[model samples]
Target: MKNIAILTLGLRHNYGGILQAAALYNFLKREGYNPVLLRKYPVQKGWKAIIIKALEILPFQNLKGFRNSYIKYINNIQFFDEYMPNQTKIMTYKSQIEEFLNKYEIDAIVVGSDQVWRYTYINDTEYDTYFLNFKLNREIKKISYAASFGIDTWEAPSENLNIKKYLSDFNAVSVRESSGQEICKKDFGKYDVELVLDPTLLIDQSFYLDMIKNKSPKNYDCITYILDENTEKKELVKKINVECQHKSVFNLLTKSSKLSVQDWVASFKSTDFIITDSFHGMVFSIIFNKDFLVIINKDRGADRFYSLCKILGLESRLVTPDSVAIDRMAPIDYSKVNEILDQLRVKSKQFLINSILE
Candidate 1:
């Protein structure tokens, strides 16, 4: 079997990131490839390491409180084990990556879908503004799978020349959205930049359906609100709630102070409609065949939603940040979105399978 290394950002928790990675891995497996995950850093080790990382994650928790809360959170989730690297004894980040790679028997490396290529996502530096430019021996097939820069738009300088040069190392390259594709083309020139489905879109809806339990409470009509760290989203969600007065609105941040990626997906699926600013919010809405609105956040990265909507012929749902009147938007025809989804799913599966065979 072909051993493929899957590299991504935030495998431990971020719902959109994890789901996209999961979908890609699942699709790669379906196409007859053994996918191995390779994270940027190693999982924390020992009580001290765990405590340090937990403290790092928590915004305002004392060391003991963070540790206890983290352990409890870890125990409750099923996918936590698979999400993070198994670093029971390992101490360093470099050692962890090497150990994981050696144990998993990775033959090829596939980096991306999330912000795997962006240095800005990891650190704050001039280099961080560019793509990762670590020196590597070019022997194995290097592929990028729908990787994103995570910025709404960017224009790097001469200092980031190496970052643009690094793209040449990859055998194949794909980005999550059209804006990403444009950036790649503009910066690196045309080098096989294709728009692949997000990892969440790579898997079928049935997989998620089988995993979630106790799905909706009674015949209650629910609406999901997936927002970024944008204040405009709060206003739009309020408008949507007012428009859909009869039904209850479930804003993810408000409903659960602590929520998992799977929990978000489950909640989104249980809803009759999903209303939000998050790209994956719109993604799950499409996957579960729910009517949704993409509240465009111009400051944040909302192009992914608009790109997917355009691809799937759900153009009507794309609402600008200035669109205060939620009631003015037209109701979506989910059946048409399904038709586009079915065709894209087939094409996306074939693209990967065909590439592997070649």
Candidate 2:
């Protein structure tokens, strides 16, 4: 079996990021390959290095903070053990990452399924790493699977000429959004890139249902998975509550959220309705066949939401928070949605198989 190393976003608090990376790892393992999710952080240098060290030892990083951080870190490791068992040691510095990759002997590297290529998220300091443009001790196949540029536009810190030089290393390329295909050709001068499903959607919903099967998720008629909560969102939830009356609106990013990753999946399964601004939230809503209303959020990469929904024929589900209030309890016909999803899943998996085997 090929020893594949995944180069997506690091294991972190974001539910979607963790799930997508785990999904990719599971998918590869099921395909009879050894897949590992590399744990990494952006390299720090100069004043940034000084500040990071300072923050590590200062009043904010007191015994209390140390205890909390330790707990969170251990919990994260345990979660990965259950889902993605083959993981590298946490590497916060460039040297650590280089040493591990060299020693581990990865046969191929997959760079994506998240906003890994988003310039604002990664910035200039880590462009080469995210692009899989690093120099390794040995040659290995480099490819991007459903990698996203976050948005449709070109916003990388480097010029297209320089980016093309780095991107040329990839043996094959696949993007999560349709917009990324155009950007691949126009900005990076790479054509024939395949557009594929997000890693989360590549797997079956039964797998996710199994995640919550033991959790005994609480019953709720409605829930809001708002990524960016605001007055408008609060008001919208209030309106939805009038119809649902079991409003359990919570931002998983919030410090107060004790909802585990598996619990979040369960929430999607238990709820009858979903109102969300997040791209993955909508993805899960569709995956679980729940009625949903999407908040138009260009700031959060609406292109991802648009591309997936457009192909699945769920355009009517999208609504701006400012739109005239409509009936939130209307049923969504997911018959065609499931059909389109099944068809896409086949092609998406085939793309990965060809990308790997070719």
Candidate 3:
């Protein structure tokens, strides 16, 4: 089996990040390849080592400083272990990716299913890492699966030429958003990029339900997952619970989430409805087939939601905080939505097959 190295954004407390990585890794393993998740950041040294020492007293594993919160962190770490079975022990960031790949003897590298290609999110110095711009000792297949620009429009960086050069080396490229296809051709001159589903959607909902089957998730009439919460959102959710008689409600925040990864997936199981400004929150709501409304998190990028809704024929679900009319909204017609997804899966899986095989 080929040793496939999967690269994406850092795998931390974010539910979407972990799930996407797991989905791709698991999908590849099922396809009969040895897949490994690669976390950026190798063993720290120099100034980074000093910063680590300074933050050591705060919390690493034990309940020394933040006793009440440290245990929750440990649970999250355990969640990481459960989802990612085959991952590198130590991570290497930026240009060091070349050495890390060599050390592992990776046969191929797969970049993304997240905002990995969103130029603004990447650092100026390390753009090479995400773009796969490295001088390797041996030639290995480099590809991107559902890599996203995060937004609809393109804003070329100063090093556009370098990006084009890097992509020229890629064996295959697929993007999460259709807009990325235009950006690739218009801005980067990479004309052959294919639009595909996010890695999370590559797997079926039963798999997620099975992971949380026995976790005993709490039932909520409405679950709110707002990444950038404000008074407007708080008041809206409060009114929603009061007006709709949603007695059991919960706020799922990854930053302060105490739930395990499996537990997090379980939280979606019992919720009748979902209110979120996050892309993945919207995704899970659809996966669970729950009635939902989305408040676009503009800062995070709204194009992803638009692209998804357009694909699933659920564009009406997208609503703004000010323009929301709860009474006027209608239930999503998932029968048609599911039909579209089922057909898209075939095309997407074919893209992967062609990309991986010669």
**Candidate 1: residue 160 lDDT (0-100):** 47
| TM-score, model 3 to reference | 0.89
1-358 in candidate 3: lDDT tens per residue?
Answer: 8889888876655778778888888788878989888777323468966755455445544333343244544566666677667777655555467777877778889999899988777534465788788778888899999999898876566777888899999999999988899888888899999888888888888779778878887787888888888887777766666766778888887455567778777887788888899998888888888888788788888999999899898888787767555553567888998899888888888898778787
Model 2, residue 296: displacement in angstroms?
Answer: 2.4
Q: CA lDDT of 46 in candidate 1?
A: 72
> Which model scores highest in lDDT?
2
Query: What would the per-residue lDDT of candidate 1 be over residues 73-103, giving only the tens digit for each residue?
Result: 5643456445433213322354454455556
Question: In candidate 3, how many Å is residue 290 off?
Answer: 1.0
For each candidate in turn, the TM-score is 0.80, 0.89, 0.89
Minimum summed lDDT over a 10-residue window in model 2 is located at: 62-71
Off by over 4 Å in 3: 42-74, 254-256
Which pairs in model 2 have colliding backbones?
Answer: none
lDDT of 2 at 225: 83
